[model samples]
Target: MQQTIEALRVALNKKRWHEARYALSRARALTNALPADVAVQEREQLSALRRMYAARNTPTAKKAQQAKSKAVGRAGGKKPAAKKSTAKSAAQTPKPAPVRDLGDRFINRANLGYGPTNEAKGSRTR
Candidate 1:
């Protein structure tokens, strides 16, 4: 039982969640079979470990870890490459064709060839 609790602590410290969970379960099972005095102490340790596991697995904790990793960068000591500008000169870019007004009667361009030709001008009565 003591050995199992020790294993749980080590796993938790190393951030090995799966191993920690397994150890916690083993400790819990062992705790059930121990004497009343020893079981109480082991239960306290298990509860604390459970709290630590829950805190570490929370969404906010994961987000904080992700943000920290991004800030640190993954390429060891190397700096990230600078992004290149994709700006184009007016001569190299084509201007979009101007849209013509189809008048207020047209609800949508796609509806011109399909569905009802025109929609009601105002709210319809029952």
Candidate 2:
């Protein structure tokens, strides 16, 4: 039991989470073999050790490990050529003719005297 505890402490001091977890489990097993009171005391110590090691294995460290593996994967292979899509683009469809503007047509009608006339010489019935 003492040997396992010493191993766990050494592993923790070295900031080795995996080894610390292993030694902690071993220590826990050893404690279980001892008297109930002694086992309870060791269990508390084991729980503290678990928390300490868990805190050290931070999310940033996990992200860094993931990034390293991805980098290795990218470096280890030639990526296959990207496939060209067989679907035709909208550019292939003929565009509809532009709308004929009416403003110019209205101006042309006024100039040609085909639009509304002046009231001065207009003939009308009331």
Candidate 3:
């Protein structure tokens, strides 16, 4: 329907790819059900929209978009404000426990009774 085609056009203009794609699909479905004479114009428009979408998805277009953003960022764009410190004094704040080296503890697993010990591996005599 013309409404769907119009929706696709608006979406494309706004760079709303998901909406544009949905609208395009709907338009295609509507166009398919129409007679050849009525569908020709819609088919042409659909092809043009497809090409536009494809162009936007290309690497060059992506790079250009990134460059545009970078330019905007450099041109007086608002930077994130630094966070203010809390009211708590340094002495009032609880210190985190120091990290211990547990590497040596796990090295001798048999001594730690984790794996089979030497006595456990040997044959048991009554």
lDDT of each: 0.78, 0.72, 0.78
57-122 per-residue lDDT for model 1 (tens digits): 789878988998789756578877996656655347687899998755424533456554334554
Error of 1 at 115 (Å): 72
Give per-residue CA lDDT, model 2, range 35-119, as digits (tens). 8776676678777776767767689767876898777655557897898665665447778899987652223334567776455
The lowest-lDDT stretch of 10 consecutive residues in candidate 2 is: 103-112
Q: Distance from true position, residue 37, model 1, in Å?
A: 3.3
- For every model shown, what is its TM-score relative to the native structure? 0.45, 0.39, 0.47
TM-score of 3: 0.47
* lDDT (Cα, 0-100) at 82 in candidate 2: 97
Cα error, candidate 3, residue 34 (Å)? 0.9
Sort by TM-score, top down from the best: 3, 1, 2
The better-scoring model by TM-score among 1 and 2 is 1
lDDT of 3 at 29: 82
Tens-place lDDT per residue, model 3, 65-87, is 89987776444667778876666
Candidate 1 regions exceeding 4 Å error are: 60-126
Tell me, what's the RMSD of every candidate? 12.7, 13.9, 11.1
